[model samples]
Target: MTANTHDRGAPAAPARRSGLGVALFLEATERFSFYGMLSILLVYLLDVRGLAAPRANLFVGSFNALALVSTLLGSRLGGVVLGPARTVLYGCAIQFMALVLLGLSVMWPVLFLPAAAAVAVTNGLTRTNMAVLILRHAGGGRSADGLATLYTFAVNLGAMFSFLLVPWIGRRHGYALAFGACAAGLFMGAAAALLNRRALAGGASGGTARAVPRAVAETGLAIVSYWVVLNFPAGGHWIFWLVTSAIPVFWAWAWRNATPAERPGIAICLILVAEAMFYGMFDEQTTSTFVLYALHDLNRQFSVAGVTLFELDAPQIVAINAGLTMLLGPVFVVLYRLVDARFGTVALSVKYVCGSVFIVIGFLVLCLDTAGGAPGLRAPWGMFGAYAALSVAGLIMNGLGLSVVTTYLPARMRTMSVAVYYISTGLAMYGGSVLANAMGIGRLHAATPIPESLSTFHALFRGFTLLAACGAGGIVLLLPVLRRLERRAG
Candidate 1:
């Protein structure tokens, strides 16, 4: 569908919170479908389609970048044509269609890249639109925490469901059936969003949906810059988890005291850059690199309801990480709240640093699993540790950072700001994948003489650790610039 061409109209003021439960429910389900498919895409390409692992990785990376770019287009379309509710509906419809196409790709096997791209765009749009809705309804410290919890809960629940469901389906039936099930879930989510139309679009308030070309252009430029800078560190970090994406988060926090004129753009840039690094690291660990590790090195198993169904493969094992997060997001939220109370204001910098520490520890354990001769060295349970880190980081960044960034921006620029942050991550995700593939060329692939030991993987980890440390340092250095910008805006 093309961008909406409806007359610009004022948004309806939010009067009720009726369908929030349903909305959150649908969001969770959709997230499950998206990530479930994502966790398995590289395997699908390599195992099912006969594509080389490196090529498959690049395809997935390209898809991620495109999807991130689509969010900008989706937000613009939402503003001009369908308004907020309709925009969300459009994204849902796209998601449904994408899922169906993905199922077909599994069945026919030629539609992989196209199907993947469609799904990516759907996810990007849905995330941005849903976020806009939540931001419109809430603000302030606790409110931000609440919204982040709700958002994280929904996503983690979806991830949790996918981890269990996809493994069972793919193991018992096949890839095609597994993808088809995901498509059905997507349709269900779309249906739920359609039922709650009013609440979704109520954020339009009284302000008409005027296309502010200058504002859009300015926001777009800032996003492009943020993405370019953000992706370099993110790409390096994603290949290995030695480093943390915490610096970007701290940089965003540093903007709290900046001038209004500049705060939104600068904050958005830093948040997106940081988040891009965070997600790049998280996704690569669970999806691409980790999946390969499990298949090649680990003893895979499928234990369902206390019964061991079969030895699950690498792609399926990745679901464990998603599942754990789905189960733990709410618990983390409660913990965050308690911690925030003790820490007083609980600045973004604090959360960023804490989250990065989790990542560092997770990787440290993984390093031990690889180098310390841990049991299951071939089929390490280190992934469970990786998931734990992802959950903690998600709570801090998605829960805490988003709230700060959204509240810190002016209303007129909020959506654009969110979009900017999103696109930055998109670039980081794609770039990181590309770099990983390149790094693996003569290093980790099937052809390379199996490294004599775990030394190769250790080297990868050390490289990433150095990158993360550098990015974190950059955050410190950039603090003055962010503060200066924010003060000027004020």
Candidate 2:
């Protein structure tokens, strides 16, 4: 891989602006399709497909893991063989086909596996490359911060609308129609990519011909590995454990290979990645544990003056986080810029610490709320507050984490580094699913009495609270080291 493939010279100002717009559009639409399908997927599996909760959760977890792990191949393909623009277009096309099959799966049922696998594989092609394109267009300095904030803003904006609309459609019409909507969104994204091909092409690194065969081989290997993990019982857990154990070894090797100037940045990136992995375990609850809690435990109705306004379904609860993210994302961007102007740079350690606090607080809120009453139809305020806190935490941790990878890593490693970060998240999601299963979330049913489940919910929330508190303590202990590394990197 040549440097040009990863570090293409910045285009002229007008072209740069145009490319950023196209990239952001693609991001927004793609997220709309992805999250729209995801928000309702768990429920669909349980209700439509008639799977038990445990099996459904495992399926969802495995799908997320495969999607992220496959990004390694996708990043290589984009960075070496197809280039970013063509890779993104192909990803959109693949996703479109997969989603159509997913829609049809509502009728055929058997198509779900292959359709889901295709979607998972397509993610590897889109996400990392899109981030690379955004970075290339934005350039450096405060643009790094801006890119992080803006990228998250685009993501949540799409997510917010999807969560609000898709679940409602699924509830009223059917899961099939909702999935069809997602496919249509992908179609629009692909059309946009085609019309703006030149602008999107500007983001490519122009990878050399020599790398194509190697990239293809690696991509094929990833596909086969994903197939094995998806098909084999307990394979996802095995892969998760293997990856978790390998992370430290990989870090050591990279540290030894890095130059003195690169070492500090690499250290900082790894630390941030660790922090993200911890946070991601908690974040996954939004779709898994939290959704289950909302579905079974919360009263989702809204009323004014003794008149019912609207009722929120379990899946609709995810919109709260997305909505909060959209609102707060810009505030963070301004805050980051203001702090950087005053203090030379916003302290990444400070961001992590603050986010860790919110994580602990979010779980604590759930614990107290659960303990306050029987599990039957408690007020939704606790869920709202917890989701709000989590949204802030996510923006602080994940948004900054992405910025750190792009800003600090050598251009050549940016896509792979991003892919690695996502793989950590995939592992976290699988772990979170396991944790949810341990709490007997899969055993829960509508008929299960609140009194019977109280201990389980209480234990789960308390355990998460403790976990978050420990993560916070770890960050505190590492603060001096993180600061020293940041200074050295500068």
lDDT of candidate 2 over 1-490, digit per residue (tens): 1122344467777777788888888998999999998889899988987877677778788878778877776777887687887778877887898899989999998787677777888888888888877777554343676788888988898899899889999999998999999989878877987899888777546566676567556655665566566666356777887877876776787788788888888888898888988888898888888887887778887665767777788999999999999899999889888886888666777788999999999999999888855546677888889999999999998887777787667765677788888888888888888888886776776577776566567778888999899999999899999989878987
Write model 1 residue lDDT over 1-490, tens digit each, in one string: 0001111342433343544565677777778788778766776777776766666666666556556656666666555544555556666676676677777776665565456656666665677777766645453233565666677778778877786677578767888778877878878877776776665556453224454444345334533543443334234334223112433443455466455565555653464356445645545545676666665555565345666666656666665666666567777667767876786444455456666656566666555566654433444446566667766666665555456555455455456556656666666666667656555522555543334325555555555556656655655555566555444534
Over 4 Å off in model 2, which ranges? 1-8, 140-142, 203-228, 303-309, 373-375
Off by over 4 Å in 1: 1-16, 139-142, 203-282, 301-312, 339-343, 372-376, 398-401, 446-453, 473-490
TM-score of 2: 0.93
Task: Provide TM-scores for the models.
Answer: 0.77, 0.93
For candidate 2, give the lDDT of residue 47: 93
lDDT of 1 at 251: 48
Q: Count the backbone clashes (under 3 Å) in each candidate.
A: 19, 0
Each prediction's RMSD over C-alphas, in Å, is 8.0, 3.0
lDDT of 2: 0.81
